[model samples]
Structures are given as structure tokens and as C-alpha cells.
Target: MTASVILAPLVPVVVLWVLAGLAVAFVALALWRGLAGWWLRGLTACALLAALANPSLQEEERAPLSDIVLLVVDESSSQRLGDRAAQTAEAVAAIEAKVAGMENTELRVVRFGDGPEDAGSLAMTALAEALSEEPRARVAGAILISDGQVHDMGLVPALPAPLHLLMTGREADWDRRLVVKNAPAFAILGEEVTLTLRIEDQGAAPGAEEADLTITVDGGAPQTYRVPVGQDLDLPVVLPHGGMNVLQFATPAVEGELTERNNAAVVQMNGVRDRLRVLLVSGEPHAGERVWRNLLKSDASVDLVHFTILRPPEKQDGIPVTELSLIAFPTRELFVEKIEEFDLIIFDRYRMRGILPMSYLENVANYVSNGGTVLVAAGPEFGAVDSLWRSPLAEVLPVEPTARVIERAFVPELTDLGRRHPVTEGLEALAPEGGWGRWFRQVEVSPRAGQVVMQGADGRPLLVLDRVGEGRVAVLASDHAWLWGRGFEGGGPQLELLRRLAHWMLKEPELEEEALTATARGQALTITRRTVAEGPPGDVTVTGPDGAEVVLPMPEAGPGKFETVWQAPVVGLYRLEQGDLVRVVAVGPSAPREFEATIATGEVMAEAVAATNGGVLRVEEGAPDIRLVREGRPAAGRGWIGITPRGAYVTEDVSVAPVLPAWAWLLLAAALAVAAWLLEGRRGGRRVSGTA
Candidate 1:
């Protein structure tokens, strides 16, 4: 309870003050002049003022509030490393008991874990929010139980009392991580590129001055190298093939290490070729000759070597052979020597004219068997006796002529296999609306051994493709395919069909008839299977980073592409296989942000503790005692921490009453005035018996 004096003036405060001053001056003047009636007049004025002034005494009742203490717990990814998780659980239970035993104190526990969107520990941000919800004056102290690897320090709240830390983890903890300082997204094939990499040791130092590093490309055997630790090294690499190249770098796990995940890294870089060479052979010039020439010449990456046989060996003119002849390029150099230098060879409207010996044709067949690609565009002469199929090349051709020709307008149809073959799939020639333009001429043929993807008039095999030895072969049954280029009956996808066909023969991975590919988009792995199988291509076998395998079925996506997306469960390299085709891909980063620094330390929260006159103690030394201390004093000691008493309270009830009554003041003033008047009259020797 407490007492206070308050005044309720009858008039305004300013007016009351002026009247009091005037009364004081009047009394002083009368005393100096020695006047008796003046004293009586002063008494009457005082009585009037006393009655106007209203004063009261107030009493209040208050209730005391307990002090609040915050206990922040760090449960983020970094805290789970090593023994920190166990350390945190033990410290949390001990602190809860210690805070509960304290007098006149309230304990608040806030647990924070891994942040959303890969943001690291946000200890300061959580502390600020808890502080805002509680009264500042009632907050006695703030204590944090963490590894001290906080990521948001800018949000640290101002302490009303003291702040302390109960740190987790031991002094002997350490970690090693692999870092790619710089790497290119693209590297040209057959050219060396430089990549900068570093190996670092954090927390406790390792005894070895050098570390063993291993690297692999495209899932091949790893190559080992000895490199000094804590230093950047430049690595020169030459891409082995033209496509996606996966470069994986790893360091062997050390004894007493925090985790091995950070010791490995994965990088993906695209490999591209510099140039491509092609060889084109024509038996004679015809209406469709320019179509093949125009297509090859338009591509800046291709170098075309065109050879046209204008005269047949059987042709015997009356003029001498020397008179009609000009410069000639020897066939021996092209067929027998440097034949592998060409990526693709196209024979258009060609036949056996006896211009070259039988040995040349046999060389061509051997070339096809030795990892070379050949395409044959046949004409009406393919069914004749002098056809190239009758030579040694017969063993390599996908089909044989039936000595018959069909010359009627017929629209080419896509076989079930063509709809699933990458080269012919999704071509305008397979559209639902009447398909492509009609061809007027096609030769009837019996398929020897290959995939017959297209049919001509009377359902005859129009296109056959096959693999002979290590090379590929494709035969088109009609010369009228070029009529589509001229928009003859409304043309077709002449350019698109031929381009994909050429690329397919060149062994483009995207156009392979039988292929398996896995693409990573965040946590989802999209697996696609391309095949010309009679029915469904079946399930795909997936191998994870830890060598675990799972068979997943594929759903049809388009004509030839079957796809399915699987949610990845972990971060590492994933290998996919469908039948004989295999592909390797990575789903997530080998080293995530959480594993970069796994060792526990209190340096991140040291500034906040010191600013609030607090101290940090290791939980390994046992739970600290809870103490009550004054603000601005040291709040921590060897094995104990302190909280300050806020002494906060709220008033419950109040009472106000006047000390003096109005009538008593009036009676006293009247008596004083009457006595002063009688004394003054007697002294002046005047009769005092009359009442006026």
C-alpha cells in the first residue's frame, strides 16, 4: 500500500494560484503598516480560499509478476552431426529442470530446426520473435543452447537483462569438404579445359599435409592424384565424347571425420564436337540431285565431298576416250584409303556400271562393317541385273530387289515400328490427315534382316534400316521421295525426315532407336526410353548413389518416347538401365549447405552474449546452476548462470479521501477574525457594545 496527496481545485489552477499570491501580499503589507482591521480582513480571505481548495490522500494495491527467462534450442541440420544431437537432448532436459527449480522466474523454451528454402540456422530470428511476445521489463534473461553456428545475426534482440549460451559438441570435432572454385559449363571435344578445385579442413587440423583425390568421367574408373591440402589446384581435362560428361571428384573419408557426404562433389558439363565430314556419291544427275546437295551445304558444321559418275563404263562413243575425258579423281584413294575419315556416305540412284572393279564394292562393304554409316536411295534400276545389290555390298544391304517396280501414286505409311523409331517418329509423314505427298515410283523388295519402318504401294517394304557389324545401313526404295521437296502433291517433311535420318546414322544419342536417358529436375528424375520394340519397351532398372537398384515401369509419352518421373530420396549419382542401354545422372548436390561446417562452435553467438554481460559454458562440463543476479553485473560463472529479478507488478485497487472537512476550516477562520476585531477596538479606547 502507498499514500499520495492530490488536489481538486474549485476553479482553474492558474486562477487559484493568482488569488493565493494576492492574499500573501496583502498580509505582508498589513503587518508592516500595523493595522488591526487589516488582520481581520486577511483572516476572512484565507477562510474563503481554504473552502475552495480540494485535496485527497490516495492508497493503492499491487500484485508482483515473476521474471521471464528464454531458453533457445538449436535443432538445425548442423546440430545433428557427430554427438551434438545427443548433447543437445541432454542439455535441454537438464536446463528445464534447473529453470523450474529457480524462485520468482518463468522459463520459455523455443526449439528451432532446419530453415525453409535451405536457409541455415536462424537462432537470432527466433529469439527476436519470442522477446516481442513477452514484456520487456519482466524478461530476466535469455539463454541459447546451440552449436553456435547461427546464420542470422542481424536480427539479434536487445536484452533487458542478461544472455548466456550452453554450447554443444566436443573440442576434438572436425570436418573435411571438397570445393570446386571454378568450372566451365561447356567444354569443346578433344580440347583441354582448366578447372580450379580445393580441399579444406575445418575445426581440428589433420596430421597429413597432402590429401588423396580421385576423379572420374562418365561413370568410368576413377583416377587418383596426390594434392596438398588447403590449396587450390588447376586440373586440365579433355572430353572423351560429344555429349553430357559427368565429372565426379572425391576424397577418401578420414578417421574421426564428421561426414563423408561433403568429401565428394559432382559436376555436369556438355561436350560438343568441332566439325563433321560427309561423302555423297551420285550415279547420275536427276530431278532430286539438288535436294541432297542443298541440304548438306546449308549446315555450317558439315564438309561435303560430292562425286558424280556422268558416264557408264559400257558406253562406247565413236570419239576417242582421251578426247572426251577431263580431270578424274581416283576411286582408290576414297574407297581403300582414308575411308574412315568420313562420318556418313550417301549413294543416290547408284547402280553397278562397271566403272569400278568388284573389289571396290567389297571395300565399301568392309567399310560399313568397320563402324561406318551408309545410306542408299534406290531408283528403277535397283531391280535390274546391274544393280549394286548384286555385288559384294549385297551382304550389307538391308533388303534385296524382287526384279519388279511399282509406278503408281502411293502415300507412304508408317509401320508400327516406325511410330516408335526415333528417326521416323513424329515426322509430318506420319500425320493422321492423309499423311505426306504421294510418290509415283517404288521397287518391290523382300526384307533380308532389318527393321522395315515404311511401306509403299501395295504394302511393299519402302524403307529398311539395319546394323551390320559395328556400322548402320538404311535403304529408301524410291527416287520419288525428293518429289516431296518440290511440293509435288502438297509436299511432306522432306527436310526434317532426312535430317533426322542423317543424324541417326551419325549415332546421335537423342535419335538412337534404342536408348535410355535420365534427366534430373530438382528432386524428380525424368527417365525416358526410346525403342522400336514390337510392344512396350518394359521397365527401367535404376541404380542409386548407394548402389541400390529399383525397377520402374515407363508410360508412353509420344510416338517413340516412354517416360516416367520418380521422386529422388537422396542426393547423389543415379544410374538408369533399360535392357542393354544405360545412362548415369545425378539428382542433387553431393555436398549440401548443412554439411559444409558440421563441427560445433560458439563463436557465432559470442558477440550477443558479451553485449548482455553473459558467458558461454560447455554442456560437456555438465549443466550449470541457475542464479539470481542484479542487472549490469556479470551473469555467469564457472559452473553457474544468473537471471535478474524484474520486480514487475500491476495495481489492483485504489482509494481517495479528503483529509480536512470544509465546515471545520470555516469555523476556525471565523473565530480568528472575531478575536482580532475585539482586541483592536479595546486598544483604540472605543465602545464595543454596538452591533452594526
Candidate 2:
């Protein structure tokens, strides 16, 4: 209960003061005139003046409100480390019990977990918001139960009372983590790029002086290298053939209080070709010579080296050999020595020639078998007696041309299998008006162990693609692709088709027969499997960094592509496998930052708590009993926690009664004057008689 006074004046004080002054003046005048019984007149005047002024007393009632205590609990990822989780559970129970026993007090418990973006702990932010929703007068104090790792300290509210912290975790905790300082999103294929990385130690590291850093590419054998702690190193790595190159860099596990899941980092670099080296060998200079040169030279990234055999070995000019304009073709230098240097070998309208000996042809076949690409652009000469089928290169070529030439205008059409293949799919642009430019000539071909992608008129094979050992080969039976480029009978996407065929034969990973691919956007990963078979979709098994397996149901996305989406729970390397395909990718941070010392030190919140006259009390030491303490007194007892009461009040107005009315005061004064006169007259008469 509480009490206070309020006032409303029924009579003005200024008017009463004037009336009293007049009464005093009249009494003084009587005394100056030596009037009989002057003391009696003054007494009568003073009694009249006292009746005008008004005064009163007011009383109020109040009941004390309950004090509010804010309880902030931390539930971030860091709190799950070691015995910290257990410690947090025990402390929460003690706090609940202690707050329950206090009188005229209420508790507001708030729990904060990891932020949505995994920014950091959100304990302070949640507490601030909770505080704003409560009454300030009732908040006696605030208590935080966390590991002292707060990411949103700027959101700490202006507390009305003291704030206390009960930190989690113990001393002597340590961790070691891998750190990637620099990485690029893309790298040129077959080029060495340098990546900067380092290993960092925090809290307490192992006793070993140095640690071994191992690096692996595409899950190959890891190469171990010794690296010093806390120092960055530039690692020169050569990217493999094509597509997304997954590189895993890790350091050996160190004995520590932290988990090893953060001890490794995964980086992906998209491989790109800066320039394609293509070798074009021609048996003789013909009308179709410009077609091959123009197509290869049109692309900025294609490095073309063309050699034409203008003069035959049997031809003997009458003039001296020096007089002839033709120079001897460097068959040995191009075909035998540096054949592997070129990515693709194009034989445009080339027949078996004596210029390239049988030995050189054998070397070309060996090159194709060892992961080199070859494209044979056949002409009428493909049906001649000197066809390449009689040479050593016949084993890798996809088609064997019969000694027959079909001369007729025919439109090219995609085969049944080619309709779904990536190389030939979505090729309506090649025949926008329902048909491509007609070819006047095409050689009859019989495909061996290869796929016939295109057929000419009369259902004869015109284009064939095949896998030759570790490499790829393509054969275009018609030499009239140039006629399309010349815009004969309505031109089509002749260049686009040719470009896709060349790129596919070079073994672009996206065009592979069987592939497993995973793409990450935010925290969700999309896994895809592409194959050339018809069956039930396979199951994609994903292994997270913590060795937890999640089987995702793959559904057919298209004719040959199967896809599934998986939401990643944590940020680290994720391994995916379906059938023979395997892929690994990193999510979130490349490596965990070593910002938290992990030792659970009070240094972060000790100063702030002390400013409010609060002391640190570990719940493990036992719950301190709650006690009500008087204001301006010490807030702690031997085995109790003290809370100070805050007294608050609101004001109200009350009416006051006047002491007396003007008419009443006037009547009393008249009566008093008459009595004083009578008394004086009697006294005077009595005195006169005595004197006589």
C-alpha cells in the first residue's frame, strides 16, 4: 500500500489575507485612541480572521507488483560441444527452481537457437526483444545462461535492473580447424593454378610441432605435404581434363576437445578450355578445303594447324624440284612426333596417301586409342580404292565406306537414338523450316561398333559416332556440309551442329554417357544422374560430413536424366553416390572460423555484469536460495540470492472544504464587539464607584 496528497482550493488564500489585514488595522486604531478595554477588541479581531483559510488531508492505497526476472538461454551449435550440453541442462533446472521461490516475482524465460543464416548465436537479440515486451518497473534483474559466445551483442537491451551471466563449458578446451584463404571459381583446363590455404590452431592444440596437409583431386590418391601452423602457402595444382574438379584438402586429426568435422575443406573449380588445338590433314587440295578451314578458324578458341598435300609422290614435274612451289609436307613432325599435342585430328576429304607412311598412320591410331579425339570428314574419295579403311586408322573409325557413291539431293535427318542424345537433342534450329540444306553427294556407309546419328537419302548412314578405346571418333560421310554454310536451298544451323560434335568428341564431362552431378544453391543440393538406359530410377545415397547417410528418391526428370533434391543439415563436405558415380561437394563455410576460444571464459561478459553489481555464480556449485532484500542494501546472502523491490506510485486529485463562510465570520465579529463594549462599560462603572 502507498499514500499521497492532492489539493483543490475552495477559498482563495489572497482574498483571506486582505480581510485579515483590514481587521488588524481597525484594532490598532482603537488602541491608538486609548479606547476602554483595547486588549478585548484586539482579541475579538484575531478570532474573526482565523475562520477564512481552508485546509484538508488525503490518503491513498496501493499493492506492490511482482518483480520480473529475464532468463536468457543459449542453444547455438557451439553449445553442443563436449560436456557443455550437459552443463547447460543442469544450470537451467537450478535457475528455474531459484526463480520459483521468490515472493512478488515473475520469471520470463527466453531460449535462442542458431540464427537462420547460421550467422552466430542469437541469445542477446532474443533477450532484448523479450525485455521490450515487459514492464520496466517490474524487471528486477536479468540472468543469462550461455557459453559466453554471443554474436548479437549490439542488441543487448537497456536493462532496468542488474544483469547476471551464468556461463557454460569448462577451462582448458581447444580446437584446430582448416582455413582456405583464397580460391577461384573457375580455372583453365590443363593449366596449373595456385590456391592459398593454411591450418589454424585455437584454444589448445596437439603437442605435435607440425601437421601433415594432404590434398586430393576427384577422389584420387592424396598427396601429403608438411605445412607450418598459422602460415599461408600457395599450392600449385593442375586441373584434370574437364568439368567440375572437386578438390579436398585436409590436415591430420589432432587430439582436441573439438570435433574433427571442421578440420577439412572442399573446393570446386569449373574447368574451361582457353583454346582448342586442332590438327587438319588433307590428302589433296580440293573444293571442300575452305569448308574445313573456315569452320575451325571461325571459333576464337580454336587453334588450327592445317597441312595440304598439293603435290603427289608419283608426280614428277619437268622442271627441277626446287622450281616447284609445293614444299614437302612435314608428316613426321606433325603425325609422328607431336600428334598428342592436338585435341582433335580432322581428316578432311583425305584418302590414304603415300605422304604419310604406314608407320605415321600407326602412330595416329595409337594416339586415338590413348584418349585422343578424331573426326573424319569423308568425301567421294572415301569410296575410292585408297580409302582409309585399308589403313591402320580403320580400327578407330566408326564407319567403313563401301566403294559406292550416291549422287542425289537428300535432306539430313537425326536417327532415333540421336533424338535423345545431348549432342543432337534440341536441334530444331538446324532445320527450322522442317528440313536442312540438301547435300548433292554422300558415300554409302556401313556402321560397325558405333551409333549412326544421321541418315542421308535412301536411309543410308551419313554421320557415325563411336568410342575408340579411351578416346572418341566421329565420321561425316557427306562432304556437302559446306553447301549448307553457303546457304544452299535455305541455310540452317550447320555451324552449331558441327561445334557440338567436336566438343562432344573432346570428352566434355556434361556430354558423358554416364555421369553423377550435384549442384548446390543455398542449403539445398540437387543431385542428377544421366544414363542411356531405360529402367527404374536408382537411389542416390548421400553421406554428410558427420558420416550420416540419407537415401534420396531419384525420379526421372527427362528421358535419360534422373534428379533429386536434398536439404543439407550441416555445412561441410557432402558425399553422393549412385551406381558407379561418385561426387563430393562442400556446403556453407569452407572451414569453421576460430573466433570462439572454446575455453568458456568469462572475459566477454564479466565486465558488463560487474558494472551492475552482479557476481558470477556457477549452478554446478548449487542453486543459491532466493531472498528479498531492502533497497540500498547488499544483494547477496550466505546461501541466497537477493532481489530489491521497486516502489512506484500514481497521483490523484481530491476536494477540500472551506473553513468558514463570509456571512458567518461577519456575525461572529458583531457579537464579539457588543460583548466587549458591555464588559468595558461595567468595568468603568465599577471603577468610578470605588473612586467616589
Model 1 weakest 10-residue run by lDDT: 681-690
> Candidates' lDDT values, in order?
0.84, 0.77
Candidate of highest lDDT: 1
What TM-scores do the predictions have?
0.71, 0.71
Displacement of residue 180 (Cα, Å) in model 2 is 3.1
Q: Write the per-residue lDDT of candidate 2 for residues 537-628, one digit (tens) a residue.
A: 57988998779999988898876678888889877778888877888877776554323344465667766666665556664555666666
Model 2 deviation from native, Cα RMSD in Å: 9.5
- For residue 687, give model 2's deviation from the true position in Å: 44
Per-residue lDDT over 459-518 for candidate 1, one digit per residue giving the tens place of the 0 to 100 score: 889989899998999999999878888887677888888898888788776888887888
